[model samples]
Target: MRSLTGPTVETIIGVVVRLLADERGESEADVRDELAEGGWELPIDSLRLVEILVQLEQELGVEVPADVESARSMRSVRAFAEVVLAACTTSDGSPSS
Candidate 1:
């Protein structure tokens, strides 16, 4: 839910990876590679996924209510981005949905 603005998709992925590394106490590079291997190209659900979500809410000052919709939307990096960007932006972070 954080208001993250950036240029590259990799940069956004990197930010999420860094947060996972910090909270999960795992090697950042390892997490990054794991995410990449999982076809995520980023860490979406390392050990600290919930912590990262809480941090996002705190950082953004937005409440992403816990529910089935939120759960389904956070199943991957791009999905999470779409949800967060929708919560933070008007355009849903895509040209079409």
Candidate 2:
């Protein structure tokens, strides 16, 4: 998980929307709206969702394991934040769980 120094879910959600907008040639606000009104499905496709997670991993100095079941359930910003937090550890790299 990443070390969130700000409003965790809000910050990450903004990042996710911005990344999606950049990848899709759209505006962040549009992406945010799409995300805000969601079903179990994400605003972007599965590939884009994975890409967002990967970007978060790089930006936050965290490794979102490929086999993490919760990682596949990022239908909402808070849920995705929880997944990232679950992967957050202390000084070393082992899972804090």
Candidate 3:
């Protein structure tokens, strides 16, 4: 396993922003607007959302419950970050049975 760095909200945001930018072939500045302009829902598709979550889980070594109800409520970047931060806060980075 790679040395686990404690995942913080900001850390997750930075990673998500970078990954979103990479996936979209855009700049971080482009992706960071949702955050800078306050919490508006991210205008992204299902495929891109999965890509971001999957990569985030891999990078953080955490398995967010696949069926989280609040996930559906994640309409924006801040919402997404809040969901992720809540997940990380609630668990110890282990697979759920």
The most accurate candidate by TM-score is 3
**Clash total of candidate 1:** 0
Per-prediction TM-score: 0.63, 0.68, 0.74
lDDT assessment of candidate 1: 0.62
**lDDT tens readout by residue for model 2, 1-97:** 4455533556666666667788889998877777666742467667877888888777667666666466565766667765665565532455543
List, residue by residue over 5-30, the lDDT tens digit for candidate 1.
Answer: 53233544566677778876899998
Question: Any runs in candidate 2 off by more than 4 Å, and if so which?
Answer: 1-7, 89-97
What's the CA RMSD for each of the models? Answer: 4.8, 4.1, 4.3
Lowest lDDT sum, 10 consecutive residues, model 3, at: 88-97
- How good is model 1 by TM-score? 0.63
Which pairs clash (backbone N, Cα, C closer than 3 Å) in model 1? Answer: none
Candidate 3 lDDT tens digits, 10-35:
77778778888888899999878855
Candidate 2 lDDT score at position 59: 69
lDDT for residue 82 in candidate 1, whole number 0-100? 56
Residue 82 local lDDT, model 3: 64
Error of 1 at 96 (Å): 15
